[model samples]
Target: MSVVQAMDLGLTFPAGDGDVVALKDVNLTIGKGEFVSFIGPSGCGKTTFLRAIADLEKPTSGTLSVNGQTPEEARRARAYGYVFQAAALYPWRTIEKNVALPLEIMGYGQAQQHERVRATLELVNLTGFEKKYPWQLSGGMQQRASIARALSFDADLLLMDEPFGALDEIVRDHLNSELLKLWDRTGKTICFVTHSIPEAVYLSTRIVVMSPRPGRVTDVIESTLPRERPLDIRETPEFLEIAARVRDGLRAGHSYEEEHV
Candidate 1:
């Protein structure tokens, strides 16, 4: 079954003189249990497309569905969890409370909320820090807590918008490995948006390359690497080849934009 399906999708923001096209003619299908990453230059509508799936941004034209339902319908059904670029955790809440906030709002009982929060925190390796506040944790640790919050509800689909974009290299690398384990353990369909080609290639089963401004899918490259990827796999020829293809796709998109402008 397809977790997400987008057909000729387009989104435009109204500007004073003329409208700004954020996404145009995007066609993609993300199947169940797939790890798909969107890679493109800044302002390429990667996050816009993600928001469209989350029903946060309504498409101007074409159709988008989540789990065979309209984005709005799916969102109302709590079909997915979204993690933003920043952790977005509330500073006032302890780690467990932060994870349980959604459950609390959703009317989950205290016992259910506590159990879900505990399981999610363990999944993100935040078990022992349940009493800490957001401000008390390091950047990477705080991000992991954010992820635990998203996973607390056990949503079948996960939408991550550059969740590690701000972390230092070592921390980012560590989280990337942990994220893979989390994906493996949970079997959630993931749609991640990122600017780094290597990071996209490393994390995604398939990489969707997009153009600038009026973002369009220029290419969708499938990875041949095993699902069990080590950071060092990046140094291998297969990894390099996929990264090169992504680079070529990005460069081609830029060249097209330059010529048309």
Candidate 2:
């Protein structure tokens, strides 16, 4: 089934001069259990498109649907979970308590919240750190806590905006491998936004490469790699081939302009 669908989607923001076209003529569909990555240079609207899916931004035109419903409707139904670039955890709350916040808001019973938090923390391999404070944990561990919080509600769709972008390469690579395993175990659909070609190619079942400014889809590359990928799989010829294509797509987008946040 299609978890997300966008047809001729466009979004623009009003500026003092006129307007900023963040995305234009964007069209794509994401299926259930698919790990799709949106890759482009900064200001290419990768994060903007992801935010549109989460109903954080309104499109000026075109149509977008999530799980057969409008983005707002799907959001009210709790159809998706969003993990921002930062950990965004509350320093005052325990790791588990932070993960339990959504459940509390949704009015899940205390027992139910407890169970969900435990399971999700376990899934992210942060089971033993439930009592730790966010500031007490390492950067990578804090990000895992944030991911556990997102997964706590058992949402079918996960919207991640470069969740590992701030981490060191060694940590990022490890988390990437762990994320694939978590996706396999849960079968949740994930929409990831990233600027790194190797990260996009390494982690996605399909890579959506976008152009600059009024972000447009330049290319969509499907991975030929197997599901059970080891970290070393990145060193294989097949992996390099996919990475090259993504690189070529970014070049084709003429992303030589200065990057914007």
Candidate 3:
């Protein structure tokens, strides 16, 4: 099943006395339960594309569908969960309460809310920290809480925008493994945006490379690595090969942009 489909996806914003084109003619299809990543330079519209799929931004001209429905319809039905760069947790709320907030607003019963919150915290390996505040946790733990909150509602699709960008290298590595485990256990479809080529290669089934200044997808590389990815896999020749391919794709996009300019 195609969980996400983007055809001729384009976005433009109004600049001072002119229009800033963010994305143009981007096409992508993400299969159900697949892990996909968008990788590009700093201003390549990776995040913008994510926002469009999440219904946070309306495309200027294009068609985007999630699960055979429009992005707006999917959003209205609460068919997806979004995790931004920051944890975005409310400081006054405990970890469990933070996870439960969505349930509360969505009108889940108290018992079901508790059950889901507990299970999600466990899913993210934050079971014992339910009562702690976000301020009391480390940066990585806070991001996990945010992810837990995203998963607490049991949404089938997750849209993550550089969720681990703030963490240190060790913490990022730990979370990467945990994320793969979670994906294996839950079978949820994930669209992750990141600038790190290695991170994108390690975590994705496919990597979409985009270019800046009217961003467009230049290449989509399918990962050939086995599904049972491990930390040690990063040091293997296969992993390096895929990473090099993605790097080439990124560089190709940049070269094309320079030629056009």
- Candidate that would win on TM-score: 1
Q: How do the residues 45-158 of candidate 2 rate in per-residue lDDT, one tens digit apiece?
A: 999999999999999999999999999999999999999999999999999999999999999999999999999999999989988999999999999999999999999999
Model 3's alpha-carbon lDDT is 0.93
Write one digit per residue (lDDT tens) for candidate 1, span 59-116: 9999999999999999999999999999999998999999999999889999999999
TM-score of each: 0.98, 0.97, 0.98
lDDT of candidates 1 onward, in order: 0.94, 0.94, 0.93
Off by over 4 Å in 3: none
Q: What range of 10 consecutive residues in model 3 has the weakest lDDT sum? A: 252-261
Q: Which 10 successive residues of model 2 have the least lDDT summed?
A: 252-261
Cα lDDT for residue 228, candidate 1:
94
Q: Model 3, 1-261: lDDT tens per residue?
A: 799999998999988989989999988999999999999998899999999988999999989999999889999899999999999999999999999999998999999999999999999999899999999999999999999999988999999999999999999999999999999999999999999988999999999988898789989999999999989999999999999988998888888879987
Better of 1 and 3 by TM-score: 1
